[model samples]
Target: MNDMRIVERDVDTNEVKIAARDVQVFYGDNHAIKDVSVDIDDKTVTAFIGPSGCGKSTFLRCINRMNDTIDVCRVKGDIRIDSEDIYDPKVDPVQLRAKVGMVFQKPNPFPKSIYDNVAYGPRIHGLARSKADLDDIVEKSLRRGAIWDEVKDRLHAPGTGLSGGQQQRLCIARAVATEPEVLLMDEPCSALDPIATAQVEELIDELRKNYSVVIVTHSMQQAARVSQKTAFFHLGHLVEYGETGTIFTNPVDPRTESYITGRIG
Candidate 1:
C-alpha cells in the first residue's frame, strides 16, 4: 500500500506563497466559484483538477486577479500573495500580474522576434537599464523556459514561426522575464503533442525550484506527475485539497473518490 502513494519531494520552505480565504467569483448573476480557501506553498507545484466548468480554472485566475479583465466578472474575499492583499484598491492590477505571471491554454507569442517576445515583459516593467541588460534577461529567461538551445541561433526570427512546443516555451520565457513569484498555467499542454507535453511537464518540475507553480489541468496523470499538492473542484466548490498522493490514493471526500475513480466528473 505504501508503494501506491506518490513520493513527495522536499521544497525550499514550508511557507505559504499564496493564500486564499473564502473566495467567490460571480459572472453577472452566476456564482462561478464558491468559498475556496487554500494555502499554496512556495517552491512547490500545485495542480487544480476537476471537470469542465467546475471552477478550477476560474479559481486559478483569482490568484493573479486575471478575472478582473472580464467586465462582468466580480471577485469577493481576500487573496494574498506573500501576505499582501492583492485586492486592495491601492494595488495596481498590472503590477500584481507582473508579480504573478500567467500562461494560457494556447501559445500566443507576440508577432515580434523571439528575442523581443521574451524581452517584452522586462522592457515594460523596466527591469533592464541597458541593451546589454535586456539581452542578458532574454537569454536567461529562454534558458529558464528550457528552449534556449533550440532557438538560440534564431533569436531574431519571428516568434510565431516556431513549432507549437517551442512557441509555448517562448511564452513561458515571456512570463518569467518579469521574475514573477508565482506562475499560473491554465492547461498549458492541452494544445501540444505528447513530446511537447512531456517537455513542458519537465519544465514545470524545474520551475518549482524558483517559483510557486499553480496549474489547472484536466489530466489527473499530469497532476500526479508535476504537482506536490492537488486540489479537486466540483460545481464551483473546492471539494478536497492535500498532498497529491493522498488525494489520489486515499481521498477523504466521496466526491473526490468518485471523480478519481471515474464514477463522476
Candidate 2:
C-alpha cells in the first residue's frame, strides 16, 4: 500500500484528502465503473459533473461504502482516507459513514422532530454524553446547517413539516452532527427553487472551511461556482480532473469539451 499524502500545490497549501486508484464497480454482468481515479482535497469542494448514467453518483457512493448495501454490487481497487483503506474487511460501514457522512439527492428526513433529526447521529454514534450534550450538538449542528435560528423556537416540530429547502438543510444538519471529516452530497440543490438553491450553495461554501466535500452535480454552472476542483465522468470513466477553472475554461479531453459545449451528452 502506498503512503497516501496530500498532493501539495504550494509551500503551505495541500491538496487531496482522499485518493482513489484504479477503482471499478460491477453490478452482476454490467460494469458500472471503469478504472477511475482522482484525488479529493481536505477542506475543499470537489464537484463531479457529467451526464446521467456516467457513474458520477456511483463513484461517490464508493467513498462512504454506500454501495455495500447492494447484494450484487462488486467493487475493486483502492480508496484511501488519510492513507487508510476504507474497504478493508475490518472497516465497518457504520463507522466509516460516521466519518464520511452523506446527503442524498432527495431531502429525506426521518419521521421525527427537527431537533431529533439533528441529534440522531450523535445519539447513534454515542458522540454525546448527556441530554445537555445532545441538545448542544443539535443546536450547533442546526446552526452550522444555517437553519437553527429559523427553527430554534420549535425544535419539536416534525422535520417533514418544513419546506423542501428547509428539509434539505435539516438533512445537512443531521450529517454535520456526526462531525464527519468528509461530507458527500448528491445533487443537493436539484430540488430547490433558485433562492433556496442559492442558500444551500452558500451553506456548502461555508461547509468547506472544515470538511472535505464531494458533490455530484449535473449543473455545470453550479460546479463552477462552488467547487475548487472538478472531475468529469463519461460512461463510467473519469475523462478529466483538474482545477475547476481549467476544466471549465480549457478542458483537456474532447469528451469533456463536447459535454461542456452541448455537442454530446
Candidate 3:
C-alpha cells in the first residue's frame, strides 16, 4: 500500500475514523441489517461477532460500501470517515474503496504473478507513477502483510501457487498495497488451518498499528484475543458493543451473554 502518503496527513488517533448512525441494509425484500449506530476509533481493532445470518458481515460490508455491487442491496444511513459523508453523490465509490480496503472470507487472489497481484491495486489507483515506485509499494505491502521474506525469492511466481496461508497473506498484502486508511475483513481466517489462523491474527494486530481494522468472525475466542472493541449483532440488531473485557465478562445485554455462554448462537 502507499502508506507513504499517509505520513503527510495529520492522523489524529483521538478522532473517530468511522461513524455510522441509523444504518440499515436491505436485500430486496429482506432487511438484513436494522438501524445500527457505532463509532470506530482510528488505529484500533474492532470485531463484529454473531451467528450466521445475524447481519455481522452485512454491516461490515457497509463500512466499505461493498454492498453497492449488489443491485438488490440497498444501504441507508449516515456513514462517515474523517467526518466526510460517504453516501454523498459527489463521492466516487472507486476512490472510496481504495481508501477502505477489504479482505474477503476466502483468499481470492488474482490469477497473476505474485508481484503483479500486489502491484495491481497500486497500478489501477495510480499510486505509483514509475516502475521503481510500484516495486517499492509491492515490497512494503508484502512486508506489512508479513510474508515478504517467504515470497520475495520468487516475485513472478503465480499467486495461486502458494499455500492456503500464503495465499491469504498475499490477499491481505494486496489490500494494503492500495494504501487504505481502514481495512475491513470478513472471516479472514475461516478457511485457514490453526497455524495459518494464528499468522493472520498476528498480522491483524500489526495492521491496527497503521490502519483501523474491522473484522467479522464467528469465532468468539479469536475476537477476544485480537480486538480491543467488540460489537455483537443478533437478528439484524446491535445487541451489545463495548470493551472486549467487559463484553466477554460482563455484558449489559442478556442476548450477548447467552450467545457468549453457548446457550444461543
Query: Against the unseen true structure, what C-alpha lDDT does each candidate score?
Result: 0.93, 0.90, 0.91
**Tens-digit lDDT string for candidate 1 (1-265):** 3422655545455799999999999999999999999999999999999999999999999888899899999999999999999999999999999999999999999999999999999989999999999999999999999999999999999999999999999999999999999999999999999999999999999999899999999888888888889899999999999888889998999999999888997
Off by over 4 Å in 3: 1-13
Q: List the residue pairs that clash in candidate 3.
A: 1-177
**Which candidate leads in TM-score?**
1
Clashing pairs in 1: none
Worst 10 residues of 3 by lDDT: 1-10
Question: What TM value does model 2 have?
Answer: 0.95
The digit string of per-residue lDDT tens for model 2 on 117-219 reads 8988999989999999999999889989999988999999999999999999999999999999999999999999888889899999999888999999988
- Sort by lDDT, best first: 1, 3, 2
Root-mean-square deviation per candidate: 1.6, 5.4, 6.3
Candidates ranked by TM-score: 1, 2, 3
Top candidate, metric lDDT: 1
- What candidate 2 gets wrong by more than 4 Å, as runs, is 1-12
Model 1 regions lying over 4 Å from their true place: 1-4, 7-13
Better of 1 and 3 by TM-score: 1
Q: Report the lDDT tens digits of candidate 3 across residue range 1-265.
A: 1221122223234568999999999999999999999999999899999889999999998888899999999999999999999999999998999999999999999999999999999999899989998999999999999999999999999999999999999999999999999999999999999999999999999998899999999998888878888899999999898777778877899999899888998
